[model samples]
Target: MIGLLSTTFGVSVASALLPLISVELFAIGLVLKEPEIPWWVLALVIATGQIGGKLLHYYAARGAIRLPRFLRREKSGKSSPGRWRAWLESFRENCRNRPVWAGSVLLISAVASLPPFAAVAVIAGWAKVPVSTFLITGFIGRFARFGVLAAAPAAMATWL
Candidate 1:
C-alpha cells in the first residue's frame, strides 16, 4: 500500500511536470497487475495526486506572467517584451473571449490523452481561468480517466 501510494504520487507529479509521459498508461499497467490496493482507492489516490500536481503547474504558469520581463515594455520600461509575451497575451485574450470553449478544452485535455494535460493546465493558468474551476473540472476529468484506465484491463481480461 505504501509503495502504491508513493508510485501514484510520483507518477502524477511526473505526468504533470512532463507532458510526454502518460499517467493513464502507468495506472493501466498497475491495474492490469491487480496489486493489493483496491482499484477504486487507487484511482482516487491517483486522481488526487494528479490534481495536486496540475495545480502546481497552473500556479507556476500564473506566477510566471508577473515577472518584470513579461510586462509590457511601455508600462514597465525595464525590459522589452518579446514574442513569448505577445503570444501569451494573444492566447489569454482568445481564452477570455471564449471562456466556455477554453474551459471545455481544458476539461477534455484532462480526460483524454490528446492535447496534453500539462500544456492545457499551463495555458489555462496563463489565460487566467479561475483556480476553482480548474480544480473541480480537473478532478472530475482525472477521476473518470483513471477509472476507465483501471477498468479496461479487467474488461480485457474477461474477454480473453
Candidate 2:
C-alpha cells in the first residue's frame, strides 16, 4: 500500500511538471483499477505532489531558479523597457497591491484550469504572492479537484 501510494505521488509530481501528462485521468484510472485505495488518500498524495512540483515554476518565476542564458531575453539596447515588460511589471505591481485578488485568481485557475494553471502559477510567484498563501491555496484547490476525480469512478458505479 505504501509503495502504491508513493508511486501515485511520484506520478502526480511528474504530471504536474510535464504538460503532456494528465493527473486527472491517472487518478480516475487508478481508482477504477484499485478501488481498495482510499479516495481521500489518493487526493492528499496527488495534491501534495502537485503543489511540490509546481513550486519549481513558482521559484523560477520568482527569480530563485536562475534561467539559462537562452531562456533569458537579451537586452534590446533601448533605454525604455519593452511594452511586454511594462505590462508585466504593471500586472505584477497590481498583484502586489491586491494580493487577495491575485490569490483568488490563482485559486480559480488551480481548480478550473481556466487561463491555464501553469501560467497562473508562474505569474503568481512572479507577482510576489506569499509563499504560504501560494502553497496553502494551491493545495486546497488541487485537493478539491483531485478528490472529486478520485471519487468519480465509485460514484458512477453507485449511480449506474
Candidate 3:
C-alpha cells in the first residue's frame, strides 16, 4: 500500500511536471511550435505515464509481497487506511452494490486518469478492486482521455 501511495504521488508529481517535460519533449523533436510540446504528444506521454503508474500503484496497493521493505512500509501514520478511508468511501458510493464491478472500476479508472485526480487509483486499490478488472478499465480510461487530449489541438488549432 505504501508503494501504491508513493506511485500515486509520483504520478501526480509527474503530471505536474509535464509542462516542463513537454518543453523538453518538443525541443527534442526540434519543433518550432509556440507550445513546446505538441498537444497530442503531451497527451500521449501523460496518458502512458499515468497508466503505468496506476498499474504499479494497483499492484503495490494489492499487497504484492515482492516489494522491498523500503517500498512496502507496513507501518502506519502515513498512507494509512483511516487517512484515506473517506476517499475510498466516496468511491464506494458510486459503486453502490453495482452488479458489474467492471463498470464501477471503469468509472473509477476514468476519474483517476484525470490529472491531479489520479490518486483515486490508490483509493480504488484499497477498496480491494480486482486487479485484472482495474488494469483493463484503467487502460481504456486513460487511453480515452489521451485520445481527447490528442484530438483537442488538432480540432482547435485552426483558431490558434
Candidate 4:
C-alpha cells in the first residue's frame, strides 16, 4: 500500500513538473513488476494522480499569465519576445475563434501523448480554454493512455 501510494504521488508530481518523462509508462512498468497487486488499480491510481498534477500545471500557467512582470517581460523583449508574443496572440486568437479546433488539438495531444501533456496543459490554460473541457478531456485521455501502457507489458509477458 505504501509503495503504491508513494509511486502514484511521485509519478503525479513528476508528470506535472517534467514534460520529457513518460510518467505513465514508468508507473505502469513499476507496477507490473509487483504482481501481488492488481495492475488495473495501480494504473487507475496513477492516472488520477497524473490528472491532478496536470491540473496544477494548468492553473500555474493561468496564474503566470496574470502576473504583471510576465506581461512586462513579454512586452520588453525585442526579437524573441516579438516572436513569442505573435505566436501567443495567434494561439489565443485561434482558441477564441475556433474553439472546437483548439479543443480538439488539446484532446488529441492528451490522448496521443504527442507534444507532451504538460505543454498542452500550459497552452490550454494560457489559451483560456474551459476548465471543465480541459479536465474532462485530460482525464479521459490520460486514463486511456495509462491503461494502454499498463496493459501492453502484461500482454507481451503472456505472449512471451
lDDT of 2 by residue, 109-145 (tens): 8888887888888888888888988998889899988
Tell me the tens digit of each residue's lDDT in model 1 across 53-115: 888778877875353565333456647789988887887887888877777787798899468
**Model with the higher lDDT, candidate 1 or 4:** 1
lDDT of 3 at 5: 34
Query: Where does candidate 2 stray beyond 4 Å?
Result: 78-87
For model 1, give the 10-residue run with minimal summed lDDT.
65-74
Strongest candidate by lDDT: 2
**Residue range with the least summed lDDT across 10 consecutive positions in model 2:** 71-80
Clashing pairs in 2: none
For every candidate, C-alpha RMSD to the true structure in Å: 4.5, 1.7, 8.8, 3.4
A best-first ranking of the candidates according to their lDDT comes to 2, 1, 4, 3
Once all C-alphas are superposed, what RMSD does model 2 give against the true structure? Answer: 1.7
What is the overall TM-score of model 3 with all chains considered together? 0.52
| Shift of residue 159 alpha carbon in model 4, Å | 3.2
Order of candidate numbers by TM-score, starting with the best:
2, 4, 1, 3
Model 2 residue 22 distance off true place after TM-score fit, in angstroms: 1.3
lDDT of 3 at 131: 67
